[model samples]
Target: QEHGVSGMFTAPTAIRLLMGYGTEPAKPFDLHTLTRVFSAGEVLNPAAWEWMQKQLFHDRVPVVDHMWQTETGGPVFANPYGVSLLPIKPGGAGIPLPGIYAEIRTPEGAALPQGEKGIVVLTRPFPGLTPTIWADPAYIPHRLNGQSLNYQPPP
Candidate 1:
């Protein structure tokens, strides 16, 4: 029953499914062998995180919540390893990693600041990112088309 999966990157929905199937805490499982737990493809709910924090990662093992999209290319935002994790919010996308710029955008290409809900957009590209799409360097401006949503002036 031991799979070679020290790293499990899955959605909260799938984690819930595992819990539904009766996957219990791991003071029993080799927590030492398990180094990291990554959640993505959906928001990580508070209850699920609490299970990991209390039951799963009591040793403070790493957990990364990747925020990404295909439009801006690969994951423009992510929780890098090695940094200490903070108390996770119930439904918050934990703050972006260092040296990266990301913002939510609206329909008309205006940028929205932190805590605002708009189209998540990256101001600059990140490591392992393709500068342009499909071998077209000049095609980037159109590709990274901005929008206006939350960061609008009072009207």
Candidate 2:
């Protein structure tokens, strides 16, 4: 209407809020200026992506999927925009971004491989990562029985 803007970075929930307000995303809008869109916090569905693309992209609007728990403060793993995305499956957290280390482990402390989901572990501790429960920051890192998670202070 007045000031023209393009591209948006927000969560899937927020996008739904805008659509609920009766904003017609398709038909007519200066969508060409829009180049990118991102959704995180939860998951991004293909249906939602198609709707948004109609209203926002005349060409192609890359949808960057991100994943990170509050414990990580923000997205530590994300699909870089404009890159090859394996193709959006109905419900799936896209592969980790470059350099993100993810480990799937079990209560017994053995690492699980792909095609198996287990307790998630990180090889490198993110500075923003909360290492322990509240008021127990100094708790020692050890396995429940034998193998355990490893932790080390940065040099």
lDDT of 2: 0.61
Best by TM-score: 2
Q: Candidate 2 residues 1-155, lDDT tens each? A: 23555667888887666666544555465556666777887776665665565554532766666788877776666665555655554345576554356788997889988879788676665434655534345434432123333444333
**Among all candidates shown, the one with the greatest lDDT:** 2
TM-score of 2: 0.61
Q: How many residue pairs in model 1 have overlapping backbones?
A: 8
**Stretches of candidate 2 above 4 Å error?**
1-4, 18-26, 54-59, 82-90, 127-155
Flag regions of model 1 displaced more than 4 Å.
Answer: 1-6, 22-28, 70-73, 83-87, 97-100, 125-155
Candidate 1 structure lDDT: 0.60
Taken over the whole model, the C-alpha lDDT of each candidate is 0.60, 0.61
